[model samples]
Target: MPMPATALQEQLITAVRQNDAAAITRLLAEGADANAPDGRGFTPLVLAAYDDHLEATRALLAGGADPNRPVGGGNTVLMGVAFKGHTGMAQLLLDHGAELNARNGEGSTALMFAVLFGRHEFLDLLLAAGADATLRDNKGQSARDLARQKGNDHALTVLPE
Candidate 1:
């Protein structure tokens, strides 16, 4: 008999957390729903990309994971990748249709997160991918403003005056 769908999904979540791409792929083939939120309300793609599991992220995307799915505080996988300075993961998320300006509950965009966390390296990639630099958080802080506030000199240098 086939493995129960719920069991496969649970195992798929575990594989993503473990960064086991092969297991993730196999579980998806066995009818795991990559978009299904686990008990924690996080989808497989969100968990994989947020944790910087590149291969696991790829497998989940291949299995039809929605790159735009919101994780906590309405933050998407791209936001997490941005904060962590993972260019590869950010690029993959972008290629998979992650929204550039998607905001979290605080109305902060991925660019803002990058600047806030001093992940200045991600600035160019995010801009090149079409992130709106003018977007402000709920506090009305633009990427540049956040950079200044956070004392991110590197980010300030990259951002325009």
Candidate 2:
């Protein structure tokens, strides 16, 4: 019998972790689910974005993977990429329809993570993308408030007053 589909999907997840773009494409063609979760519960898209695997990410996105898949706690690929500080990957995700305003369980958007992590490139990118910086978190803290608490002067400088 052929390999189980779940098993094939597991291999696809592995291919993503290995940064094997060719294998990712091949596996996708062979009926593997691009959204398969790894042993640790992280999906291929999540792994690709987290590791800044641009080619792998592109392949996955082309294969119809969800750019907005929730990693956990309601956080999405864009949020993770925001913290990773990869503008290209973040832009790719955004172009793929990733929501700039997706919130974590704490109600924080990608813009909030960019501010908390001090990812200035992402800060500018998010601001330009019209992210709702005025949105608040579970503590009722807006991105600007979080910036103030973290002493993120740069974020404050660019965030609308």
The most accurate candidate by TM-score is: 2
Error of 1 at 8 (Å): 0.9
Q: What TM-score, to 2 decimals, does candidate 2 have?
A: 0.95
| lDDT to native, each model | 0.88, 0.90
Task: List, residue by residue over 1-161, the lDDT tens digit for candidate 1.
Answer: 99999899889989999999999999999899999998888898878887899999999998899888887799888888887889889988888888999999999998998888877668888987778888878888899988888888888887766
Error of 1 at 78 (Å): 0.4
Reference-based lDDT, residue 70, model 1: 84
Clashing pairs in 2: none
Name the regions of candidate 2 deviating beyond 4 angstroms.
none
